[model samples]
Target: MSSDLPALILGVLCGTGGTIGYVKTGSVPSLVAGLGVGALYTYSSQRIRNNLPYGIELALLASTVLAGSSVPRAIKTGKPLPQVLSVLAASGLIYYGVKFMQRE
Candidate 1:
């Protein structure tokens, strides 16, 4: 599988989660963050796939945003969704961070 596949999947999941949150609770913030971060992840995936610049950086940024937002919520609420998101986003951070460092 391609390395960017994970980021693409993460983007789709984030978008879907955001949409679901909006539909269920009318959370405009959730919708906006979801779609916005999803778009950023998607763009980063494309850049990585094409070997373009800043792909890893962008992915790292998106992951950091996701982790930053979700970790506190997970700690505060003990909710499964935030916990899962925190784990996924953290994984993305580690993965992309390593990729970024490995680049000469």
Candidate 2:
């Protein structure tokens, strides 16, 4: 599969998760972080699709942030959502990280 596919999926999941969090708990932070990172992932995915610059870098950054935040939450809360997000983010990190390295 293309590297962009994972980013796209992550973007959708993040957006959906964020929306759900806001609707269920009225958490503005969740909404903002989710939508913000989701947009980044989406834009990066588009960039990657178009063969533009920094696509992998942007995805890597977003994935790093997501992993950093979600991993701890997953560990602390042991919730399914956080755990899932953590896994996806970590996967994105590994995927984009490898792609980024390969480009050099």
TM-score of each: 0.96, 0.94
TM-score: model 2 vs. ground truth: 0.94
Residue-wise C-alpha lDDT for candidate 1, range 1-104, written one tens digit per residue? 77798789989999999999999999999999999889989999999999999988999999999999999999999999999999989989998988888885
| Model 1 TM-score, all chains together | 0.96
lDDT of 2: 0.93
Task: Give lDDT: candidate 1, residue 84.
Answer: 96
| Candidate 2 local lDDT, 1-104, one digit each (tens) | 99788889989989988999999999999999999999999999999999999999999989998998899999999999889999899899989989988999
* Candidate lDDT values, in order: 0.92, 0.93
**Residue pairs whose backbone atoms clash in candidate 2:** none
lDDT of 1 at 9: 90
Clashes of 2: 0
Candidate 1 runs further than 4 Å off:
none
